[model samples]
Target: MPDVQDCLPTALYRAAQVRELDARLIAAGTPGFELMQRAARAAWRALRRHWPQADEVTVLAGRGNNAGDGYLLAALAQRAGWRVRVLAVGDPAQLGGDAALACAEARAAGVAILPWSECAPLTGVLVDALLGTGLSGAVREPYAQAIRLLNASGQPVLAVDIPSGLCADTGRVLGVAVRAELTVTFIGLKLGLFCLDGPDHCGALAFADLQADPRLLATGVPAAQRLTGAGLPALAPRPRNGHKGLFGHVLVVGGDSGFGGAALLAAESCLRSGAGLVSLATRGEYVAALLARRPEVMARGVRSANEIQDLAAAADVLVLGPGIGQGAWARSLLSGLGALDKPQVWDADALNLLAAGQLTAPAGNWLVTPHPGEAARLLGTTTAAVQADRPAAALALARQLNALVVLKGLGSLVATPSGELYLCDRGHPAMAGAGLGDVLAGLLGALLAQGLTMTAAAQLGVWLHACAGERLGRAGRGLVAADLMTSIRDLLEEHSPCLK
Candidate 1:
């Protein structure tokens, strides 16, 4: 299990919440300057650790506390006799309080402070301290150009906190954002640094507590939970006396004719993930292929609705819509399955069908995983709108469908109908390939069959799937869904404790 250092708070607060925490800490006797100094030192330590040999450091300082952090970091570098320069992006005279003190300290340490200029010769490491999480609107004027130049510098950049033009509440980039190779965030873990463009812009992320009182931090609200593998639910190992029927059955519906691989992948996930009985109802043409791939799964080649009725009736869990296309045959099959009141995990075209108003989501324990575009369709909005506010969008879908909704993205959000929300930030970008969602749906269905509730199944399934992606992603690109199954079993084995 990974350390709980990443788990800060589940409630993502605005920039004001962080400020309030700072104020509360100061009010409780800790001097504001002391806290600022701690943050600077924390960032400096991370900087040195990340770029040990880089002697030249360009600190782009603004007029706020964030700049104070940059200035102090520059002072630390200068004191070490490293070639450090503070390219003040904002008016240096405008800096006040601890920030002003930090600037004076940097100057005293022989770190040259210069005004923002195109000819500043930004070489080596560029530290972005221009706009913090406080900025709400699009980055304007000189700052925007500065961000552009910093991005073009090709020098490995480090953002002081959140990236310059990213919304701290939502990971949405404020028009343009600086892409940092490393981002050292302080105080509390901001939610915006994990979702949307946050993952892309924040590169390798590091967090510091600034040695603030944990009690004061407890009083502060969290903006969002950072999902890792630490808090995942454990599936106990099967006992010697356990039988195949004890684990429950999972029925997958999809793969009309030519798209049989989708259903096969879903069934395979369920079969491998510990489902006692795994079955697939698909086109007859694919039956031999599915059996050839995994003989354990009971593959039924169903061309009509009648061929699936009995199977749907007996399924402990149903995985719907992985390549079930929107044709008449697909519609007829789903319509029949929708009438059955069983636990379901819907994905891919099934979600698309619901978004298109072709059918209503069936009642009972259900989980729906949709990407941003499908989520937008479900919410009757554009994909941009959905991406801008994913947390809200996930909640809305959960309420509308009366099911667990997993909004798939950088930080996958799982929202239950009961207003409960869970986040899974464990996957790698290599999992962005095809058949991944099918694998997720099958895993979730297997969990449901194994007696986990809709929410638990969804959350656990997401964590397992994402963690597998992260583990296998080390090989980089061209990660196939099948590669994750065995690795997932290995992880599950490490997680599950078996008593002799």
Candidate 2:
């Protein structure tokens, strides 16, 4: 079996979409049973490689074809002269088609087949073949019990296709899912694997296409495009004659009172991400500190909306609301910018103010970066609801606001007004602290100011930000918000150098 990690698939599909692809493959000459065998072989190969010394196996089997994969794997283990047991959590009498055939083959091969009971000893490497991509609702009845047992087994567990009791579409834990050490997914890459609860449940994911026809795959459109080095778009190369004014001016307006650092972070990002001229319109008290910190930026101590208006008039792009509190000052800035034609990126409290009805969502040429909580506020929903389907929430935000949306967290989703969605599955947990959003907002501003379209800026900024975080996260833990600034420029140059 080939290592799926080496040759990764960029297109992600819903569970139903993967099932459709499976049906299409079966229709295109590969038998369903044969595909199941291929899947089992892939899982077995991954399992052996993962736990080479663990020969003994306990497979939790259900009624569906997922059970078929388990049964077939038990037979494969038996043939390899390894001890194997198939605990039938699903009634064997109800097993149908390929699954029934697989059960018969496993039994004839002298594999120990026992009805799953509470007392069944879960030993060696546990195989979670209980439920696959077909699960639509909560893990019910005996399957739920089996999933609980598999989780509690405390043994090395390998999930077939996906972790049992996890939603294949939304990555929602369906009444609790198996905590598999390795999850071998088949056919197509499911969208649920990287977002929400998916990453928590799926320890490590491996994909096997089961030798599907390339022509068959060509007929299907992906639900969302995955952002990778191979597929990402970067800034175009700069000519040797490029100068400071060539990249456009960026105005970062935020940093109310105590949150002065938020605005400064964005300002630093502007200079780092190739913004030719950067201006900062922040609280009066922060001016000396910002100017001393970064002399490249023209830091202004803006007392009123009138002063910000003067800066907004001359700037090419605006990054608003890094540390802008939901006070009189924030409202005045929003009202002043209401008439500006410049492209903008709004984040942090800007989203909060928008959700709170204090600010109007701009029509177009603006990008909004919101975490789940901010997204929920903007959508008039709860954080749980937003997390349930992040992709959908992102799209809704874009459509409702008629602006480009970056729903930040986990697999950060970028949605455009034209209905394009891109997922950046980069970044590290170490990059999960305060002030990150401010950095992202500032980076987005620089990208847009460099003359990238709303979609291009959102996508590229997110990729660069996440990729930088990933590169720096190697140091391990305590990754603060300000750490991303310099690496961003390094990566930007590496990815799309200014000079040819």
lDDT of each: 0.84, 0.88
- Candidate 2's displacement at residue 187, Å, is 1.3
Error of 2 at 164 (Å): 0.6
Residue runs of model 2 more than 4 Å from their true location after superposition: 1-6
Q: List model 2 lDDT by residue over 1-500, tens digit each.
A: 11123367888888888888889998888999999899889999999989989889999999999999999999999999998999999988999999999999899999999999989999989999888888878878888888887788789999998999888877888887999899999878888887788988989888888888878987888778888765657788887888988899999989998999999999998888888999999888989988888999899988777777778988999898999999998999877585577798888998899888888766567889999999999999999999888888888888898999999998999998778888887888889899999999989999888888888888789988998898889899989888898888888888787777
Expressed as tens digits, the lDDT of each residue in 1-500 for candidate 1 is: 45333544444555778888888889999898898889888888888899988888999988998899899999998898888898988999999999999999998999999999988899988999888889899999788889999999899999998889998877999989999999988777777877788889988888887888888889864644555556666676678899889998999999986788899999999887889999899988888877887898999888788888999888888999988998888888887677677888888888888888887778757789899999999989999999997877888888988878999988899887777667776788899898988888888888888888777777778888888898899899999988888877776667665434
Clashing pairs in 2: none
Per-prediction TM-score? 0.93, 0.97
Model 2 / residue 496 / CA error / Å: 1.2
Candidate 1 ranges with C-alpha deviation above 4 Å:
1-14, 497-500
Q: Deviation in angstroms for 470 in model 1?
A: 2.4
